[model samples]
Target chain A: MRLKLLGLAAAVALLAACSSDQDAAGTGSVTGATSATAPTTNAGAVRPGTRQDFEVNVGDRVFFGFDQYDLSPEARSTLDRQAQWLNQYRAVTIQVEGHADERGTREYNLALGERRANAVKNYLVARGVDPNRVGVISYGKERPAVLGSNEAAWAQNRRGVTVVQ
Target chain B: MTMSAFMTRCDRLARLAVLALAVLVAGAAAARAELRVDITRGTVQPMPIAITDLLGQGQSEGQIGRDISAVVSADLERSGLFKPIDKRAFIQDLVSLQQQPRFADWQVLRAQALVSGTVEPQPDGLVRVAFRLWDVAAQQHLTGFAYRIEPKAWRRVAHKIADQIYERITGEKGYFDSRVVYIAESGPANQRVKRLAVMDQDGENNQFLTDGRSLVLTPRYSPTTEEITYLSFFNNRPRVYLFNLETGRQEVLGDFPGMTFAPRFSPDGNRVLMSMAANGNTEIYAMDLRTRRTQQLTNHPAIDTAPSFSDDGSRIVFESDRGGTQQLYVMGADGSDVKRITFGQGRYANPVWSPRGDLIAFTRLYQGRFYIGVIRPDGTGERLITEAYHVEGPTWAPNGRVLMYFKETPSSDGRSRRARLYSIDLTGQNEREVVTPMDASDPAWSPLIP
Candidate 1:
C-alpha cells in the first residue's frame, strides 16, 4: 500500500510538471527564450523560440464584439496566422479558450464562451489545420484577463486565447 | 396524540369564553360586542399585533425566552402582512402564563391581536414553550399550543409559532419556517471565494457547509430530503455533487468525462437535471437516483442548459440558444414537442418554474441591465418584476408567492463589487434586502421542513 501511494504521488508530480511546462511554453517564453537562432539546431526538435516567435510576430488572442460569437475581419486574420503556426509545429496540440465580459448570467456566459471558442476552432480547421489537434474550453467570465468593468476593459476581456499544449 | 391533546384544550377554552361572555352580558345593560376581523381579502393594511416577551417559568429571567420572542416578532414583521406593535405601549405587564391579559389595555393601544407565552427550562437540556393567541376586542383566546424542544432549536420553535399565526391570519401558507441554502461569497472581484452556506430564512443560524478550497455554484436543496445538489470545481473538473446535510456526506452524481453544471433537483427529489458539455457542445441531461440511469433530454447543437422541472414534474422549462440567441423554452419531460416561450428583446436565462405551476421566473438581460421577471407557462403575460444593475438566479419560496435573487452593485473603482440577496413579492411590491454577514449570492430556498 505504501508503494502504491508513492507511485500515485509521483504520477501527480509528473502531471504538475507537464502542466507548468505547457504554461511556460505559452506565456513565459517571451522572456525565457535565450537566443533567436535556436531553431536551426534540429529538424524535429520543438524549438524553444517557436512560442515566443508566434506570440511576438503573430497574435495569440482575438477580441470579439459585445455578445457576439461571429469573428471580425481582424479576428479572421489572427486565426490565419494561428493556423500557420499550428501547422508548422505539427506535434503541438492547442486549446482555444473562450471568455466573456461580466455582463451576462454565469450559465449563459458559459454557453456564449463556448460558442466563441468553437467559432475560433472552426475558423482554424477551415484554414487547413488538423481538426483533431484543436480542443476548446469555455472559462466564461470566471477567469478574466482584465479586472475593470468599463467598456475598454470589457473589450479586452471578451476574447479567445489559443494556447499551445 | 399530541395534536389531539392540543385540540381538546382548545375546546375547553372556547367553552369557558362562552360562559364568561354570558355573565358579562347579563350584568351590563350595554350589549357586549365581539371584535372580529375579516381577513379573506388579503392583508392590504397590516393588522397590528403585540407579542409580549415570554416569561421564564422554572428559571429566573432566562435569555432563551426573550430571544425566541424577538425572533418571532421579526419573522412576522418581515412578511409584510403583520406589524408588531411597540412593547413599550403595553399597559399591563405579563407576569405568568396562566394570567389572562387585560383586553381594555390592549384595546387602548389599538392592537388587533395579542400573543402571550411562557418558557420553562427542563432538567435534561429541553425547554417547554407554551403560547396563546388572543383577540384583543373579543377578550377571548383564539388558539394555544405547547412544544418541547431542545435549547439549540429554540429559533425553529419561534419560526413555527410565527408560521402558525401567519397562516391563521393570512389564509395562506407561511414561509417563515424555512431555510435558505446559498453560496456565501467573499474576496476581491477578480478572485471570489464561494462556499456553501445555510441559514434560517430571516438570516439567523448561519452555518457554512463547505470550505472555500474549491469553486461552488448554484446550491439547490431537495424538496423531500435534507440533501443539496451543486456544481463543484474539484480536481480542476466541474461536476455535480450531492451533499447530504444530515450526515455531511457527499458523492459525485456520475462519472461523466465532460463538464456538468446548472444542476437542479426534480420536484420529487428523485432525479437530477443538469447540463453536460461534450465535443464543444452543451446539452441537458437527467439522471434518476434510484436506477442510476441517464437520459438525454435535449440534443440541440446550441447550448441548452439550466433545466428546471415544473411543479408536477411533467414538463421542463430551460434556456436554450438554438434560435441564434439565449431564450426560454419548454419541453416535455421526455424531451418532446419543444416550444420557445419568450420573444422579448433581451435574453432570458435561468427559467425556474414556480412551485404553484402557473408561472416561470427567469433572469432577463436587456439594455445593459438585468431584470428578474415572471411569465406564464404559455408564453403570455410577461412581466419584468424587478430591475437592477446586475440581477440573476431567481429562486422561489416554498409558497411560490415570493422570489429571492442576488443583485450586485459595481464599485466606482471597479476593483470591488458588493453582491447581496434581495426578495420581492409576486406582485412586484415589498422589495427588501436580506442581510448577510458578508457578500453572498445564488440563494436557493428550501421547502418547509417537516
Candidate 2:
C-alpha cells in the first residue's frame, strides 16, 4: 500500500513538473511507473493505466559504414519502418543520435555523424513525419557499443540510435 | 640537384674507407631529420623512410612476419612524418638477412633509411623480433636490437621498431611508445561524468585512471612517470590535484583559496605552472611540488590562463586578455619581461611551447571560428593546422610530431551533447580519432614510458 502511495506521488510530481508550459507538441508523459514500466502514449496528453509491463527494452540501433553519412538501403528501410510507427504515434518525439566508428578523426567524425543524423531526419520527413518531431545529435565515436580493438567492435560503433526524449 | 649533391657527397666519402665508415655511421645516426625534432615541432618533408616486408623462409608461409612488418609500416606511416615506401617498388627481398642488411637496393629507391626485420616463433608462446636500421646512402648498419615477447605484443614490437627508427634518424627520442592522458566523458551535456583515462599514442590499450566519482580535466604528465598534475572537481570544488600514478594517491597541490586550472609541469618537472582564478580574475602561479610553496608569476586582473613553460624553464608563454583581446604573451619565470608575442586576426589561448624550444601550438578563436595553430616563439610563421566548430586544448606528443585535442558536437536540444578526442599531424594529414568508451576530451600526452 505504501509502494502504491509512492507511485501515485511520483505520478503527481511528474504531471505537475511536466505541466510547466514547456512541452508544447504533447508528447506522452512518463509518470508514476518505474523507468521500466514507463508508459508510451500515442496522444500528446497524459494517459492513465497505459503503463506497459516492466521490461527494460534495449532499443535497436542503426549502423553506418566507414566515412559515409548517407544511410545504406538497409538503414533507410529501417528508418521507414520506424517512421511508420512514429507517424502512428504523433505524441512521441525521438532524439536521434548519430555516432561514428573509431577510425577517422574526431571533429570530422562529429560532422559526419551530424550529417548521418540529418540524413535520417531527412528520410523521416520525406516519409511524412513532422520535422519538429525529431531531434538530431552526433556523438562522434564518443560512445561505442563494444570496447574491443577488433573490426567487429568498430562496426558496431559506426551507428546511430534513437531514444525517447 | 639535391639528390645529386647528396649522392656525389656519398661517392666521395666512399672512396676514403675509414673516413667513410666513421662519417657514414655517425651521419646514419644524425641524418637530415625534419624540423624541430623535439616534443614541439613536426616534420615538413615526410620522413624519407622505407620498410620492406621481411621475406620469411619456411613451410610456414611468413604470414605472421608479413603482418608484423605491415603493422610497423602502418604505425610509422600514420604518423604523417614518415613516407613508407611501397612494397611493390622494393628492389630487394632481404628476408634472408634481416640482421646483416643489403643497403644497395634501398639506396636505389632514394630511401635515406631502411627498416628490415624478421619475426621468428619460439617453442614457447613467444615471438623473437630482430630488426636493424640501414643507412641507405652511407651503406652502413646504424643500430640493431632484438627482443622476445608474447605474440600479442607484435604490435608493440612494431611500435618499438618505429621508435628506434625515429630516434636514430631524428637524433631525439621517439614518443611512439608513450601514452596520452585525457578526460573520458559520458552521460549528458550539462552533468558530464568525467574520468581520467590513459591510452597508447596509437589509441590502443585504454584504461581509466580515475573512477566516475569525480570530474577531471587537463591531465599533465610529469617528466618522471610517477605523478601527474590535473584539475579535479572531486567534491564539487575545483582545484589542482597531484596524483601518483603508481600508488594511486592524490593530494591537492596548494592551499590556494581559489580554483586552479591548466596545470603543466616545468621542463625539469620540479615545479608546476598553473593559473589560479580568484574572484573574476585569474593569474599564473608556479608551485613547487616538493614544497607546497607557491610563487605568483602574473598579477593580472584579466583572464590569464593556460600557462606553459619553455624548454629551459626560465620563461613562460601564456594567454592573457590584458590587451583587451586574448593574445600570447611571454614573461620571465620570475614574472618579469612581460612582452606580447602574438597580435594577429584572432584571439589565441593555450600557447604551449614545443619541447624542442622552437614552435608554440595554441587554440585561436577568431571571427566566430576556432582553430588549432602553431607559431614560432617570436609569433611569426603562424600556421593554422585545423579549423573546426569547437576545437580546443592541444597537447603535444612526446616527439612533438602530432597533437591531441578535443572537439564538441553541437546538439539541437543542447542536451544530447557529445565531445571526443582527436589527434592530427602538425601538417594536418592522417587525422584520426583516439577512441574511448564514452565521450572524451582534454588530452595531455605523457612522456615516453621508458
Best by DockQ: 1
Positional deviation of residue B249's Cα in model 1 after best superposition, in angstroms: 3.0
Candidate 2: list runs displaced more than 4 Å. A1-165, B1-68, B85-95, B99-113, B119-128, B135-140, B148-157, B170-173, B411-418, B428-430
Q: Tell me, what's the RMSD of every candidate?
A: 8.6, 16.0
- Candidate with the greatest lDDT versus the true structure: 1
Give the per-residue lDDT digits (tens) of candidate 2, residues B1-450: 322222222221111111111111344435344322342454356666678765544434266567667867877776666778887887765645554556776777878777776666667645566677776777667765676655555555667678877776656667776767788887643235779887777777677878877767778888765577897866645688998766578998888765677789998889999876543356889998788689999986665778899888988998877887678999998899989989897678778888878889998877656888899988789999988767887888877767888887756633254678888877776678777777888788877654
In the predicted model 1, the residue pairs found to clash are: none
DockQ of each: 0.28, 0.02
Query: Candidate 1, residues A18-106: lDDT per residue as tens digits?
Result: 53213323322223232112122222433333543454556667888988888998899889988987887788787787879899888
- Extract clashing residue pairs from model 2: A26-A44, B40-B354
How many angstroms is residue A15 displaced in model 1 relative to the true structure, after the best TM-score fit? 16
Poorest lDDT segment (10 consecutive residues) of candidate 2 chain B: B13-22
Query: Candidate 1: deviation at residue B401, Å?
Result: 1.5
